[model samples]
Target chain A: MNGRCVITVGDLGEFGIVARIAGRLPQGRTVLLGPGDDAALVDAPDGRVVVTTDLLLENRHFRLDWSSAYDIGRKAAAQNLADVVAMGAVPTGVVVGLGLPATTAAGWLDDLADGFRDECDLVGASVVGGDTTRCDLVVIGVTALGDLGGRAPVTRSGARPGDVVAVAGRLGHAAAGLALLQAGRAGGAGPGDPAPAELETLVDAHRRPRPPYPCGVQAAELGATAMLDVSDGLLQDLGHIAEAGGVGVALDLSAFTVPEELETAARLLGADPLDWVLTGGEDHALAATFPGGVRLPPAWTEIGRVTEGEGVEAGDRTSEHRGWDHFRT
Target chain B: MNGRCVITVGDLGEFGIVARIAGRLPQGRTVLLGPGDDAALVDAPDGRVVVTTDLLLENRHFRLDWSSAYDIGRKAAAQNLADVVAMGAVPTGVVVGLGLPATTAAGWLDDLADGFRDECDLVGASVVGGDTTRCDLVVIGVTALGDLGGRAPVTRSGARPGDVVAVAGRLGHAAAGLALLQAGRAGGAGPGDPAPAELETLVDAHRRPRPPYPCGVQAAELGATAMLDVSDGLLQDLGHIAEAGGVGVALDLSAFTVPEELETAARLLGADPLDWVLTGGEDHALAATFPGGVRLPPAWTEIGRVTEGEGVEAGDRTSEHRGWDHFRT
Candidate 1:
């Protein structure tokens, strides 16, 4: 191990690191001009562009020991891309701003770039440009751009009182995984210990969330009234739609089917799976409202209905879940 | 002072902080939907969008002690917007991602947001959307988007032999200001001490770079062969133009008129004024190559000529000024 020298970011410098990252990414159809220019030129054929940004800080957002650089990269991209789809737009490209310590191994950055590229590839998008700076810790800021493709954006304020609330993709898996990880770190069977395959899948879900990309467009085509990605939990995000549209959400408790992986992890960790399903975040699921009679595809599951009152109600109980607040939590 | 209660970011929480910031910003004409949505919708009238990203880290990019929250916000927005204009586009909007310590004062963030708005207003843009998260320090990521206006982007790779190299906007002022601040911190006349008005101007330049925004599109309309913003010093950035176009640049030393403020600061600090002009970064001046004999606008000044060889040669001297490398420097 001593014989193999690790090349750090300082060794290659900013330009060299940028070249390496840009070299690994393949351009998508929307990128008229890619990295190396002062700014990238992206085709916005619809005459309107959808933009969103998110920040991920080391330790605050992810632990280096818990997740690999690749995992962090994927999570960062997925979160931002999910936002674009939630706007009913097809993602065109992403421009990243990275802050890393000089002592970081250069290979870690290469793997991170690969992770960004792979995640983008899934949606037929690419990383167009980025800026890198030396900082005391690792910080990643991803800004994703998308085209509306002539469709009116499905905003949070569009849901009507009689509309049906639905979701696409998994819920509670990431929260359950997070619970397990926290438990493991607190003297339970640690990450290094042997675990059941079901538990491992939950851990993987927390590490890298796979958001349903195409479902966003499908919901839009199917005439979604209001939509957003479930980032700050289902109830909390639904509250946004409720507040915006001046309508209330009533979620059916029996409508949810807790995955076996989440159930297994919750049982092992002695946690409430329902609480995670209702209040846990980072699943990147698509939640939208449609007209009461509109047909939703198999990917979408009707979980609730819009009501005249304010706030969110799950079954017969008023939801007290405020979800994740960065500063307060 | 003892009786006054300070509201920290933690007190406001993420939603409160976001609401406070968004409530203060006025949406620009380009914004179809602003801060309340999952993503912002910005008009791209020309069917193409120019996008760029930049990261500014606390202590690494700005010192809270030296610059106010307002100044940091201005600089952040200015730098990213400069990149957009450099692409021969009219800036439309910006999306910011902020990471801040929970203990930070809520007022500081308000001022920062105000700074973003004021700076963007200069070019008819607005802060469309942003994400705020808790972290150990303040980290800012700004992504600026612009409309191409059907103009071909003047990339750095289009320069050719015999093209005239010209520049618009002040150069080396920010560098001089930085030198003055560094000197002040090193026990030379401190910022607290009263200084000459000229020196104060230099310091102000470093804190808030005012790039000549309109000149970018002007250059493009006037048939600029190649162009880029001079953020990495004149010689080093010109070297990029040289390397990209497979040509050489020969800058005329006599053509540069050292500003009085820079000269005064240099004399006080016992540094070479020319060195600052050639090697200082962050002024955000526009440098472009134009066809020979084209009637140049009054805003543009002929500085040099693109030559048949490689690298940059200034006044018979091969410059050794390697500009700032975030990691190495």
Candidate 2:
């Protein structure tokens, strides 16, 4: 309680910190019962709930040295919500499992909670309940729940031979950002430090991916046969759709106009922008297959078509390798 | 996958391992959708869903040497599911977020998924969806969703003076097991290594806690005023009920009969069995308060009575400290 004292998470303890964080969360309509109980209750109007979960480790998912707690929180929520969106559902709530070192600063946790709140606010969701524990490193696990609003879920196994494959939102930006960080081109900026002007977008994309959340539901309503979020590279993710639907995909590489932001980063790194577009992952873009005659949504661009065969081919070049594999390293 | 290859998770890759695991799970009625997609859909027929999450880190929550992958999976699922049960709901599905080292064996993952599936099957639920990533250690985050059957949630803030405090399931068993492990009394035995018969019960209880799942809904139907899963020690957890309801609890020490199993362990360790009952945690038993004159269930034990005040007292002694604080160490 002293003015000069800087209390850590250890000082606040698990219950005290939970109370502090719970006080900061804004209650949304979906949550019938909130935190401070055995469990939280959420409305599931459609008689079904869509669920997904993701785990982010300190160095594996994001480096605390490079990203603020706020960035980590936002990115975690974005990716999880994107999964629900891919299932043609509206995100209703998130329950977080946070493992922090005992010596972690209380301020860092507060910032992290703020990040979750801000991201959830973007899509009208709530942080309902969670668990906290002590560990040697910072580990975050988020489980997102969503309501379907009575729509049939668009799964990966529904594509027909004549369907057109389309994408909504940015591509390869996160990978380019990663490339910049790997090349030390983003400049040595820590949290709250001013990132260099040239690489700001790239770095921010890598640190906090802004997923196009509503596109999944839109695609489903527009008669999407199959859909998935592109957390892995375009070709690799498309391969999942191909394999699941027992169809082949022929991509029109020329259809992809490299975003100007990625182009500048590509020029600086002397790397092929096409490679990032084809193989880069973590952009959280929504990819779906619609009936050939269906009118595409405004944000969607037709990238390819489903064919009779198997696997994916882009511009007569069969991909010899798929996009990012976590175990590749 | 070849017999001579002895492939690990690193060799299987994320998608490959996910495929292997997904194929093993048995589909249930509650799962409108299952894994191998961005998200899974589950039936929430009650119109509202009960949700809870827990994060478990290796070494901190469980040592790989001490627990089998199957045991770890079951324990993690049990703790999360117990939280839902405490809310007077039937667990319908679980989403897991797993962080594993690349070098983890494929066999270990299979066992873990099997563990999750088996536990879900026991409660007639299903494994809906999950995410996996590479990390230095194995970290598991589970979010369980439950249906309340249109019953009002039994929150922790509803107890009143003269209410009867009751518990369903074991106490002090896990702590006694932990004590045996800490004192090096339990011989160094891996999974299936024939634990000494004397300490087998304690050790097994520590590795996997069997919660009284159906008892929670029964308590709620019986008009429980306040309830929680006693993941923290009995006295410590009861203190939560007291604080939340702005009341006091008077525990009758004579009402507690030291289990014969814990008594033997206590004699060997030269420790008080009562201390383990009062302060040991992780048993995950359900503790609840009901109005006076309510008929207690067969599994329920009337342990104390609610008093007008704050904090918890047992006989003439008021608890000086609460049970397991994650930051205490």
Identify the candidate with maximal DockQ.
Answer: 1
lDDT of 2 by residue, B194-264 (tens): 33577778888898898999899999999999999999888889999999999999988898989887887
Winning candidate number (TM-score): 1
- Which 10 consecutive residues of model 1 chain A have the lowest summed lDDT? A185-194
lDDT of 1 by residue, A168-230 (tens): 988887888787787773224576554466577777888899999999999999999999999
Q: Is the docking of candidate 1 incorrect, acceptable, medium or high quality?
A: high
- In order, what is each prediction's RMSD in angstroms? 2.2, 2.9
Q: Which stretches of candidate 2 lie over 4 Å from their true place?
A: A1-5, A187-198, B1-5, B187-196
Please give the TM-score that candidate 2 achieves against the real structure. 0.96
Inter-residue clash pairs, candidate 2: none
- What is the per-residue lDDT of model 1 for residues B1-329, given as tens digits with 9 covering 90 to 100? 11248888888889998999999899989999999889999999999999999989988889998898999999999998998998889999999999988888889999999999999999999999999999888999999999989999999999999999999988998898888888773223575544476577778888999999999999999999999999998898999999999999999999999987777777777888989888888989999999998889899999999999999998644667778898788
